[model samples]
Target: MKELTKQQSKVLACVEVYLNKTGFPPTRAEICKELGFKSPNAAEMHLRALEKKGYISIQSGSSRGISIVKSQQAFEKNVNQMPVIGLVAAGSPTLAEENIEKRIPCDPSMFSDSFDYFLKVKGLSMIDAGIHEDDLVAIKKTIDVKNGDLVVVRLEDEVTLKYFKKNNHNLELIPANKDFSTIEVDLREQEAFIEGKSVGLIRTH
Candidate 1:
């Protein structure tokens, strides 16, 4: 295998990251904007170098036509793949096997800790935290959490993402946005369990 130059390695990393997030290769203009290149020609040159080194396949005259070659295995070893479970409502298990939609590959080194899985956010309740609808939120599997920590909670049969708060005998699931009401569950009457803590988030433009 041929070793990559610094610029070629950076371009390859960008391509892999884009492919993992969007399931498609980025355009030359997109690469230029991402790498702060003055022009698309710079991005083109880097892409050509990557292809020449057998790291990627580039289809001419096609937008977003780049594809990873067999050499990508080296890069794959550095990433962590996690399942993207479907939307968790207000009363169910977020990690239910049936709710698993697909798996997403991401660079775990970008985060401070290891994550158990990814959840596709489905509402505006956490918009203030920069978590929007359809964003992929990385969750760490742990029930040990502190007050005001964003967590995935199972309230009866439903599940929700909110800031957790314990008040004497009650549990409060606070939403980041004021438009959404805070959920207060009486621990004596209903069971509220912490599913996991949100560690990081991924959004695609």
Candidate 2:
């Protein structure tokens, strides 16, 4: 709802990622470390401004309790110049901040819809699908999907990448690894959420 300055947005974005990881907001010092601020007070100043403008809120006496208050709809529509890091899980959601490796510039037009962020691949889990470690997976931040699409999903609260299949009410996640078994879930038995579908890929070797 409120316009954030470039610095404010940068700091807030980092804070949001960190919060997703630790389940607690970052301290001023931690924020400084991530943003290259010379002093904790510099981070404090930015945090205060974000709070004053309604972008975030501070919980008294809590070290990691800063909360981001932006709406998902607004975030998707107004994402201008936001750095795309990698992809997050759709079948298995990983909100952990440490998984976010680096920031890469992206043209959001490459995706069919809005995406909140990107997750860097860490292993060869999807090598057969051409998704390698250190690759950047571009995901449109939406839940709607179809068969044969690559998706990031959270299974049992852990983030995973896979191709999706739906038959009646049975959901299946096919892995790229031949050694791995396909994960099947009954919508009535387990809860699964699709973070987004893989729209594009970035590779650097």
Candidate 3:
């Protein structure tokens, strides 16, 4: 099984504790109250990371959607092919047919974590972080990821890659290069969704 980072472990523990106490998984709001997070989004970020690591499985369309995997074998990656997404359009899903540049046979074990698809890097906002133009980044689709992780995010249908940092009700999309400025989003007013976390990068150039 892939080792979880310190924060990831804490989130897992939080989920376990809530399950033991309430006889069901905790809602994101409950996690915020327990974990001292300023917003539900913070709790969600950690939950998504836990789910991606295979320690838990999240049932969509539920407020308290977390469930334990309970088996090491559940962590095994079995992806067959990975879709390469390019230029995601507004109001379109990330993996929409028109956005898919190509499909490549990708070995599951090639990356540290299981990925949903590859997003072709288009710009230099994260150049200092070693991600360059035309790089194919392994993206694990999730809304919640640890702060400072490289994240693919969508704001009002515009997709971009940046370091994610959340504080209270405001989240910052930080650029790695000096040429670019960090984008600040107010969760109260602006809706920014985290599309995925970058687990690996494939550079052909």
Candidate 4:
């Protein structure tokens, strides 16, 4: 494959992330918004360049018809295959056999540590950290986490992503967004426990 320009590389990464998250390509307008392009035409131009470079295939006249060429996957063979876990009921394991929705391909080198799975973010709690709704958060499975770490925690059966902070008395789950209130769990009474630490994020347009 030919080298991609910086802007073209951003566009290609956006498309690849979106495809890995949703199993389909993004629309031109989506690409424009994601890359901060002034117009969809700019996105179209980048897509054309990507196609010319043999990175992606565009289906003429079809909306959201972009597809990554199979050869591209060959280059990403070292990428990790992580399960995208869905809902976790209170008292159940975070990656229980029944909670897995599907597995998605992730670039392992994106993080320093290997990830156990991906969790589909569902709310605006972590928006200040640029984590948006529907984003895939890569989680390294571990119970050992420190203060100020972005972690996946289970309170009883409910699971959430928050900045972890703990003291002698209680655990604080801090939300990045000001609109949401911080969660406080009593260390002695609650069933709260760290499931994993968030190592990376994959945002789709």
Candidate 5:
């Protein structure tokens, strides 16, 4: 977990305890009351910091909307940096000038595999795999792929994230969520290519 400041640690502790006891995260007002803060804004600051540091996720438009994603530290800034790709335009390469949002400094050792770039996920097709829209999926560019690997692939004009499996000339792009169906492609007809494989993911700050 990211090292929290003394006050942030206290607020996080309070939230953990409250969530454990009540099955829900405490509201900003409740957090302030518990920590004896002068106002909710003070608590909000700490909460936002926690979220940014990848310790929690805050759902908008609701009170007590904090969800503990995990007690893990995010990538620390280092010499290595990578581009973050936004919504990919159809028929364009993944690394096209129009696709990249910006680059951020990151520690190369954060994930087991070194990543070339970060792609901003576009939908909930991989939600069951814990990858949601707007999340940055670490991508390692390569055409050499294996079955059952979470991958970012290009299907003609579209780039999508899915589990990959290839057999003969047929390829299956599987979705983790039940709401979506698996995409099957034939190498002989439809255009498809492996852009990269997902090495890891981090929420958008």
Candidate 6:
């Protein structure tokens, strides 16, 4: 797989999460919201980059034409033909499989170089991070992250996503919502685990 820049990787991960949750794809505005970008154009630029990098395929003028490439085997299975599902959102992961519309043909080569797995996004605590209610934030599993990186952290047995920041000798798990207070942990008090870093958002609605 090709190496992804920090920004590119984050956007891509968000996309995966949205897909797994809603079984659909996200719009550019939705992408901007989840990734903390000001303009949808930023999302569009990265998407184009994702397309150029062979991690995604975009159908111009269509909002639901985005698809991720899972494996080379699947890509080879259908050279120019693949499957397109219905519009997908990234908030809830517990939808009935029956809700899935028929699959349309697509190209897997579009997303051949991105990471694996999709995370279903829930809740709106991450709105400042652009993760709104029902947005699916795609994530790439990796233990590696620098201080202050936006991460999916399981704290106190609850799974929450936030930026990993440090203050003095304690670590700060900061939420995006102003209504929510930041979490401070003594390095010796307990352990904060990192599940993965976010890549992209797949908004369905």
RMSD for all candidates, in order, please.
Answer: 13.3, 12.3, 16.9, 14.7, 14.1, 18.4
lDDT of 5: 0.80
For every model shown, what is its TM-score relative to the native structure?
0.58, 0.55, 0.59, 0.57, 0.58, 0.45
Cα misplacement distance, residue 14 of candidate 1 (Å): 34
lDDT of 3 by residue, 67-162 (tens): 776322222332345678874546434565456676566675588887888888888889999988889989888876989899988889788889
- Candidate 6: residue 156 Cα off by (Å): 3.5
Score each candidate by Cα lDDT.
Answer: 0.80, 0.73, 0.79, 0.79, 0.80, 0.63
What value does the lDDT take at residue 197 in candidate 2? 84
Instruction: Name model 6 segments beyond 4 Å from true.
Output: 1-113, 167-169
Considering lDDT, where higher is better, how would the candidates rank from best to worst? 1, 5, 4, 3, 2, 6
Cα misplacement distance, residue 173 of candidate 4 (Å): 0.3
User: Per model, how many backbone clashes are there?
Assistant: 8, 22, 1, 2, 0, 31
**lDDT (tens digit, per residue) of candidate 5 on 46-75:** 999989876678998888889765432122
**Candidate 6, 25: how far from true, in Å?**
30
Q: Candidate 4: lDDT over CA atoms?
A: 0.79
Q: Which of candidates 2 and 6 is the stronger one according to lDDT?
A: 2
Please give the lDDT score at residue 169 for candidate 1. Answer: 88
The most accurate candidate by TM-score is 3
Taking the tens digit of each residue's C-alpha lDDT, what string does model 4 give over 1-205?
Answer: 3667888888988888777778788999998888888799999999999999866789999989887752323234324545677535455345654576665665566678777778888888999999988888888889999999999988877889999999987899999999999999888887687888988887777
TM-score of candidate 1 on Cα atoms, chains taken together: 0.58
